[model samples]
Target: MPIQNPLKKGSRDPYVTIAQQQLIALGYGLPRFGADGELGDETLFAYGTFLVSQGLRAPTDERPKSITPAGTAALDKAFAALAQGGSTANIIDERHNHPHSGRSVSMPYRPWPKITAVVLHQTATKIGEKPASWHGVPIHFGITRAGKIIQLYDLTEVCNHANGLNRPSVGIEIDGWYAGIEGRPETLWQPKNLSTPRQPMNFPTAQAEAAMTIVQWIVNAVAANGGRVTHIHPHRQSSKDRQSDPGSLIWQTVGLWAQNTLGLSDGGAAFTVGNGRTIPEAWDARYTGNRY
Candidate 1:
């Protein structure tokens, strides 16, 4: 049957359908016309309510804004390819585990034990950059801007965080760019070429949401593995003085989702600006006495 005129005006695409389904899964039960591609007012209202429940204000307008971090994350989850029915979902280092690698995450070089924590980074590199780096970066899985889950690593153990991927912790490098301190709240704009000065890389709302959903899955994985999940640190967090792949905005937004949606503890800290390290600053001897 053709999508009705009313629903067709702003019909929910496949990604939005996934979002609608996820919202229903989370008990929102937005009015979906049996997955027929028609999103009704009831569905919109339900989504708005879900937002409010997560401590975000309801969307003032009928049409929701996709650019917001929360909105983007939801869209991502809605479209994610779920884990094998009963099996756990994890992203392992494909470099070591790929059938072509001969050895796998199962034996010899597991990227674990030594892995102290999970590092989240964004591939600031352009979408067209060929031969994307798969070095010490442990990002095993990533959600695409279109809400697709791209598996770059397996959760077998770990491979290499440095030389040979680490075993225990996994890395997730999202395809996005920081909007920079001065240009945040604005979408990233692509640069013309290598010769052009570095500019903010913009990620679609659907993609940003996908990144957050991946974080939610990671938190669950950490709990199941018995690894004390401390910091969902961005690449910049590890090298404060030097690197900053995932700018502060992505970190904070994703961290909040981990804390709020999945109900994961933000490690017992109030709120730190950069990494969102949950361990209260007071507890850390390194903290000189900063409140936030």
Candidate 2:
């Protein structure tokens, strides 16, 4: 039997047990209280976190007290995808929901075997969770501030995100402004010769976890399609202007973590393409060069 709609706290339905099993399988832990069929705080927190990961709810929003039809549907879809050996990562596929205005018309289709890296980037501003918020943005994937992964293009489309590496890498734009160095203030260009000063926002834990999940998803996806992703790069490695594109905090949290945990590389210390800047020593002591 399917999970009854509006399953709320204090309900004692057997379906609650089913829901608990599914949540555990989906990687949401009810560690303190295992799937005991009691819709308590632990279960509710996991459910709310799952909703936030799927972009269905904002991090700042209150935890949902009841499971609605939409929530059940999302859970079913995600669980089904996971059963099929697909990614359990919360990704909203909007590849066809928006126009391909962000992709260059002159670029040829890239074969899956050609993909070798996942380039990380920061939007330098906040983007809404909806697909419409990513209109005309040239990135394959965008993770919203709410920790939603929105797929804007097919991996083979070769959107012009990372220069030079564009043909061999898939780009992910992490939402929010992150400074090159944590605790340092940054700014964005404004109209005329003006710039707007802003404080660096800390990369939320939810967003960081989503980044890791997506990178692993990309690796698995590429491998299934006859390719291998051997590297994870910061956008700075491919563009001088993007020296702080993802910044130190992001590089340490995501890029370095990927390299260490996922066995991915940053193309080594002296590695850089075009007129791009190398990963600074501050970001990773592996790079002995002066901070750019």
Best by lDDT: 2
**Candidate 1: clashing residue pairs, number:** 31
Best by TM-score: 2
lDDT of 2 by residue, 1-292 (tens): 2454698887766556556655765788877865566888788888898999999998955667887767877776665444234467778888888778777567757889998999999998778777788967898999887778888899888888989788889999999878776544643312255465566776665676677678889988999999999998888898988878788767866686577556799998888999888888767765676576
- Each model's RMSD to truth, in Å? 12.0, 12.9
Give the range where candidate 2 is weakest over 10 consecutive residues by summed lDDT: 183-192
The global Cα lDDT (0 to 1) of model 2 is: 0.77
| Candidate 1 global TM-score | 0.48
Q: Candidate 2: misplaced stretches above 4 Å? A: 1-86, 186-196
Candidate 1 Cα outliers beyond 4 Å, as residue runs:
1-116, 127-138, 159-168, 180-193, 225-230, 240-242, 261-292
